[model samples]
Target chain A: MKMAEKRPLDDTELDGLFAAARSTGPEPSGDLLARIMGDADAKTAAVTRVSRPEAGRDVVRARPGLLATLLGLIGGWPAAAGLMTATVAGLAIGLATPDTLDDLTGGVLTSVTGYELEDFMPSYGDLLEEG
Target chain B: MALDALTDVSDEALLIAFGNGDAGAARALTLRLTPRVLGFASRMLGGDRAEAEDVAQEAMLRLWKVAGEWRQGEAKVTTWLYRVVSNLCTDRLRKARGVGIDQIPEPEDDAASAETGLQDKARAAALQGALDELPERQRQAVILRHIEGMANPDIAVVMDIGVEAVESLTARGKRALAAKLAGRRVELGYEDG
Candidate 1:
């Protein structure tokens, strides 16, 4: 089909046409904005979480408990050695005097309850004196 | 206070801030960019409001995804966004079957005097009808150059064409629009020559 003659719009007319079109330009709806912002928030949250290990590490200082603090104060292998030493010493003492542990247990129970122990019970002070 | 701070930041800076988890920056960028995208998409999609909205949102979504990796100095942010909107509108237009312009509702404007506003709407509708009849590239070039008032170089970037090509398309587009609208001048409230 033969095309019609192209009659160019005058600049003034073009301006009027454009002005009318510009005035009629669509505004982004509130629903659309909310949806886009929601997507942004989600993606931002994802990026933040992924990067948290590096940036957030300093902000998140983990507090150790009391036992952990004490253990840390003594430091690494020395704490373990100290615990082993105490355990060995107690075992040696118990083997040397088998009744010592039993006597101490009974004497502590009798003192606390004010219940007299039988003749077999020995006080901590008496054992010390004997040793 | 922070929102205030972000208000003056450049669009690139705002996107970077948004990538770093600033809600204020996202709001600022959204306010700055969405309307332009919506307007461009609407014009490109032949006044299809719903499709234009979808295109705008999708384009913005792509922008957010790439914000952290958006290389500054590579491209202008607005240029990049316009390009995205252009591509998205193209994709939808290719896939869409038949469209009804009558389905498009008139804009709500409570601020203007009723008669003037109605006339304005009629003129706008007439222009859009003329625009829809143009080829896609011509329509885009004309809208960007005329209605959006973008510079030729910027229009070239958005349309992915040479600046000379941009000028040619716009000139032809204007001529066609004028030919189409010549009969409606009186109805559009234009005085007779």
Candidate 2:
């Protein structure tokens, strides 16, 4: 007796096989996942180091310089500016007393110190005459 | 953010987060992508789990390296990954051409409780054997289309070919597979038509 001829898998049969393959697909082992995550972490760290200068020696450079540190201690630029203005005004008042300031103080500073402004800071002419 | 929280996140977002050194994203991406990558590599490498694992690792390593440069909204993450795996597999296959096909290991068997599970496993194994006999491009096209359930346009992107070409390749590949699997119908639990 002759045997029946074999036939190719139909589309439905092939699709069934594909479905089986999909269902039985290989999973990544824990070791493989660890290795991959390790790579990701390493890569991410490397990229972070490159993109963030604060992570490296640049961090030291990024620190406040001497002037900046002083300014920060004095409460930033606005406070420094105010302090500077007060220092300049005080020096101006001491070097060349404004009549208005003297009036405002009621000459109490000179009276209490027992010295006129010229007594503390003599004119250039006084030095020239002494020479 | 928690890994579970990232379940709804897109692959590109996770990749960008990973690029930014988010450990959570890294874990989420690993859990999500590694299985798919391994499965595709295993099929591409003819069920050599070891080689497939190596390929998947290398491919993912490359993905991590390129994560910083991965432009958003330009390409699909899985598509880009598939392309990378395809190239890596092709390189390995070319280098291993000197090795005989018989040296390739068979697919691993899974424990199945029901007879139907056994039948499915057999069918899958027989299909894998047939696929291994196909030309590399044909095998790739068929696997991407059928097993991976990718659209032709996406397969074209992964393969770097036109849609028409992808269609042609898949058609031809299906024909080749049908011919190759013709004799195994009964053995694979299929009734002769």
Candidate 3:
């Protein structure tokens, strides 16, 4: 609701107005409750960085696609999204992976790598000749 | 380690135990928090229950991962959770601006009896619509204050704002909310507090 005139309502008055409005509104239940909570939970899960910079920027600012740059070139910084899709995409890709060790199971790094079972067996020619 | 101890313990305590590789503490904390966090997420995202649940689960997982590093008195566990959830919502909601809520399976029957359950469902649906119209900050403030019954100071801390600012936001937000629902009081069938 738009106020036609500049209303100098006290804080208490404003509180009452809001309370009355909200009271009259419906109470959430059933699926809706599930829905809101689900959103909140998903949000919490995804929040990686807890503290933000006071300067209102993350330590790094992501660069958007050329379109964003073009927009910036033509207009100004206002054209850029607060978060660049490229940067978040890159970060997400980065976080999803960690360093891995070489496959010891498939390679000679295994303890048995230097020796072959076949080679350890006495050769038939040597055995027969010795006999 | 015991159920009683875990139940009585604060989230922070359980987290510390989890850090030390206490499986029981991890289970207890997840079970204790999952439902409430799920509920909060559902409400904040305007009936997107499935997405909300996903968000909650992810948030909980992250919380578990960071349990060891958590410092005492940095923030209340629950408040920290709410703040985290809100930020996630902001990110996803922005992405989902034009996207409709994905279709998800709904249970026809649950604990409630049929007739009253139907009525409750209608009421809940109505409430969700009105809530959707609220500004993000107002909706969050309302949910924390009225639904979660958090103190002003705690809300402020979670919101990353001053006490006075919290008061003003809540007040203005609630007034707008009240104005929005002026005529629906009788339908909701609850006396105004």
Number of the top-ranking candidate, with TM-score as the measure: 2
Better of 1 and 2 by lDDT: 2
lDDT of 3 at A70: 85
Candidate 1, backbone clash total: 0
Global lDDT of model 3 = 0.63
Considering TM-score, which of the candidate structures 1 and 2 is the better prediction for this target? 2
Question: Candidate 3 lDDT, tens digit per residue, B90-112?
Answer: 78778778765434233223344
Model 1: lDDT of residue A19: 90
CAPRI quality level assigned to candidate 3 from its DockQ score: incorrect
The residue ranges of model 1 lying beyond 4 angstroms of the native Cα positions read A1-9, A53-131, B1-5, B97-113
Clashes of 2: 0
Instruction: List runs of model 2 lying over 4 Å from the truth.
Output: A1-3, A54-131
Per-candidate DockQ versus the true complex? 0.37, 0.54, 0.01
User: Of the candidates shown, which would achieve the greatest DockQ relative to the real structure?
Assistant: 2
The i-RMS of candidate 2 is 1.1
Each model's C-alpha lDDT?
0.82, 0.89, 0.63
